[model samples]
Target: MNYTELKARHRSERENYASNALSLRLHRALSWLNKAEQVEDDDSKFIFLWIAFNSAYAQESGQKHYDTERERYIAFIERLVSLDSEKKLYNLVWSQYSSNIRSILNNQFILADYWRFQSGDIKENAWIEAKNKAMKAAHTALAHNDTTTVLSIILSRLYVLRNQIMHGGATYGSGANRQQLADCSALMFDIVPLFIELMMAGQHQVWGDAAYPLIEH
Candidate 1:
């Protein structure tokens, strides 16, 4: 389910759909996914993939106060898992990428609490406790085939990587983060396409309106 194949499928089927919001989201997400496939740099590839993921999941709150970005995407994951009747996502997690997923979970640099502790905003024990707690929860979720929970935790770590790159927190082409970048990009390369395909398959279900939709003059 690469971009080319997914686009062909969308063109063949999308005409019957009524929601412009989903159409727009798939368009944006697929375009970035196409760009990601062409780029050679790990940082560029990961950032582009994150944008694609964001395009697929992001939505407007339609109110002044909105859910946090974490909440918004976690909710999206819940919807995705519910719609995944064949367990494609769960099998992808458990069968194909379990080791890669475990490595990402254990990387403290990608944990928000680890950074807080590093900055002295939190004590060492607090962040360590938080890290252990998160790992235990993820391990339990994986054992139970909890697709939504495991996917949510994986994306949380990826979001930390996204922030580091998007916010100038990482040195360009730095050797230190290269492995993490490569692993994250590899995971996303498979996952984002499935996400787009899943959304296309479940278009009748309510996916809230995409944020910042297009407007004609």
Candidate 2:
């Protein structure tokens, strides 16, 4: 569902059933998703969309040690995919964004290891071999109808792009990586909404407490 429909549905049905944690997550994520829809600049749009994704998946950790942000989100994706009996996510991965996903996977410029090696941080060009392996694995997963694996790999690539923009690694409005930014932003436009929808549908599952939930003083 689009942002409008999703917002209405949340008010009419989901808000009543959502746990305190899920309610906070959906509200924060949906607000960002709506903001992204009004944005025209690809760079800004991508940033807003990524915030929505982060809002949807971020959780509070009471322990001193916890899963890395990457691991947590990957696990979140696995759960969402498992709950998707309608195969909405599978269809989106296999049919809607396959070519764009391939483009992202093949772009070594976005890979952190590629830059690390170039900067003399590492002696070997291991990222090349790693990238190649990831590409092959992604293609194989696609062929085998393994949507979970495909989505995970695609998310990893997108995470790299996100870091580049958010961490001041990329120039604003530069032509160098315009295509990559556009492609990533477009895919996020679809994926973030679907994620929020799936979270609402699967509210019965434990999503953990949201980080920094609202509290009345």
Candidate 3:
């Protein structure tokens, strides 16, 4: 959506929004997340970005943000109901922490075989397990079945790339590996923005003009 133009438009408003201590943190965080998205290669970064964005959103609005955000997603509905620990909305705060969940899972899956292979103990099954769990958690948290295939494939591809980075080579063969790498890059760059919309209640996109998917659930 012409991020440069939009950022220029909101620069003054954001600067004014930053005058308050909370908004100030949010302003800094929005900038940080923007930068993180540009170079983020791991789940840790996504986790950090999600936390920063979610906190900023919470501070910017209120508990209602959680509800509205949950309503936008298919799976988070039940989780949201169970997350209102502060009794903010309806005693459901789990959904409130969904972003954090995604970040952790993303990181874990990405490191799958690499962590073990680096330790000189490459258990293919273990790697598969980690990748599987992360995919299930991520897709489940997203609560959208349509994306299950793409997200799983993309996440696995990214994990494999990290695996290669850690091992300095490829055991999954070159052609397949390169294809997966390209797919992973596409998935990360393309899907992450839609993900942000689903995760943050009021956060705006910084990269594109894509419309949110029409979710019925």
Q: Give candidate 2 regions above 4 Å deviation.
A: 63-65, 122-125
Cα lDDT of model 1 by residue, 1-217, tens digit: 9999999988887776568888888889999999999999999999999999999988766833445889888887888888889999998888655577777887888889999998999999998898788888877997898989988888888999999999999998999898789889989998999999889989776676788989989
Clashes of each: 0, 0, 9
Candidate 1 TM-score versus the reference: 0.94
Candidate 2 C-alpha RMSD relative to the actual structure: 1.8
Error of 2 at 58 (Å): 0.4
For residues 1-217, what per-residue lDDT tens digits would candidate 2 score against the true structure? Answer: 8789988888877656647788788889999999999989999999999999999988886722445777878888888988888989888887765577777887887776788888888755588887888988988987887877888888888898898888898998999989889888888998999999999888777677888878889
Native-to-model Cα distance after best TM-score fit, residue 150 in candidate 3, in Å? 12
Model 3 C-alpha lDDT per residue in residues 1-217, reported as the tens digit of each score: 1224334544545543313443344344456456655654443344444443343333323323445442322233233323323333221113422543244345543464646765779766777676677557656644543333333433444544554554565543345344444334433433333332232222332221212212358
Candidate 3, superposed: residue stretches over 4 Å from native: 19-111, 144-177, 191-217
Worst 10 residues of 2 by lDDT: 61-70
Residue 191 displacement (Å), model 3: 5.4
Model 2 has a clash total of: 0
For each candidate, give its TM-score against the true structure. Answer: 0.94, 0.92, 0.35
Candidate 1 residue spans exceeding 4 A from truth: 63-66
Which candidate gets the maximum TM-score versus the true structure?
Answer: 1
With a 3 Å backbone cut-off (N, CA, C), the pairs that clash in candidate 1 are none
